[model samples]
Each structure stands twice: as structure tokens, then as C-alpha cells.
Target: MKTKQEESATDFLKLVKNMKYFTKLKSDNSNGDLFNVTLKTASYNELNLMVSCLLKASICALKNDNSGYSSASESGIDVLLLLEMALQLLPDEEMQLLDEFHKNAIDRKAEQ
Candidate 1:
């Protein structure tokens, strides 16, 4: 059986593939999704900078939430949801490392 990480990796790949088609579709706004356009047009360095900013934001969000894992805080859940989206922007190796870290965190929470 595939490990959870393995399944997650597979699912991530599928989502990336699906995003290609979604990107092709026209948005309701005439501007046509500025974020999507930026992602498509940005240089490698620009994209890297954007991802770094997102990581910083996620860290700040995570740090602001004080509630212990046993009792989920609204902010904690929001941070996790944001982190999930941020994970998609990361390179595979970094993504895997973060993914493992998150899994370990959840496992530790379950132990408490």
C-alpha cells in the first residue's frame, strides 16, 4: 500500500495537471485573473520571490495562533488551509520536506 506521503504526492501531481486546464479557461473578470496572469508571466526569480513571501506569511499566521493542536483554533485551521495552497507553489523536494514536517506535527498532536 502507498504511504500517505506517496498518495499525497500523486494527488498533488494530479492537481497540477488539472490546473493547466483551469488556467486556460476565461475568468469572469476582463482582467482575466491577475494572479493567474502574473504566475504565467512572471520570471523565475519573481516567482521564487512570491513563494518566499507566501512562506513568510504562512509562518506569521501560524505563529499568531496560540491554541494547542488538541483543540483546533480558527486561525490555526486558516493557516493550514493557506499552507496547503502554498505547498503547491513549492519545488518538489521542499514540498516533500514540508509535507513530512506537517505529517509529523499531526502525528504528535494525535499522541497528545
Candidate 2:
């Protein structure tokens, strides 16, 4: 039997997997050049750490008692760092495509 925390973590993983933003690949094949970005799933350890941190943050936030809370900035930075670790798991090719996409977005914004 799965513990409540484990169940919640599994549910969160399922939610993330089903989200198109995370799983979808961006591809545009024009001028005989193919630009493909592959989606990479987080490793078991990475997912566990991320879920644990997120759950702890949520639990702290929901505490109505006069107990102290973690600094918002610290929690936010932890989340960001976790996300960065997840992204770093992507393959080199995928990272390159992502960088290209980011650069294109920046260029577009600059044009406007």
C-alpha cells in the first residue's frame, strides 16, 4: 500500500507527464533542416527530491497555527534549482534546440 505522500507524488508525476508543455516536442522542418527538441523525463531520485521539497513547502504554507514558515525566497529558489536540475537531464541535442528556441523568442521580442 502506498503512503499518502507516495500517492501524492505519483499523482504529481502523472500530472506532469500528461501536461503537453512538458512532453511535447517542438519541430519545424523547413529548408531541409530539421529542428527537433526531445522531452526528457526526470530520474527517480530527482523526482523524489522535487516532490518532497514541494510537498513540504505546501504543508508549511497551509499551516494556520502560529508556527514559523520557511522564507518564500528560499522556497522559490529551491523550486527553481530543482527545475534546473531536471532540465539538465535532457540530452545535449535537446538542450541545443531549447537554446535555439529561447534565442528565437528573445529575438522576436526585441523585434517588437
Best by lDDT: 1
Off by over 4 Å in 1: 1-38, 67-77, 93-112
- Candidate 2 residue-wise lDDT, 23-60, digit = tens: 35555666346445564447756645665665665555
* Tens digits of per-residue lDDT for model 1, 1-112: 9999999999998998987855655455657554332246356567677777777877766665543533235544566666666666666886589899999999999999
Error of 2 at 88 (Å): 20
Per-residue error at 34 for model 1, in Å? 21
Model 2 bad stretches (over 4 Å): 1-42, 64-112
**What TM-score would you give candidate 1 relative to the actual structure?**
0.37
TM-score of 2: 0.24
For model 1, the run of ten residues with the poorest summed lDDT: 32-41
- Model 1 residue 77 distance off true place after TM-score fit, in angstroms: 8.1
What is the alpha-carbon lDDT of model 2 when measured against the actual structure? 0.61
- In candidate 2, the residue pairs with backbone N, CA or C atoms under 3 Å apart (3 or more residues apart, or in different chains) clash, namely none
Query: Relative to the true structure, how large is the alpha-carbon lDDT of every model?
Result: 0.68, 0.61
Error of 2 at 25 (Å): 8.8
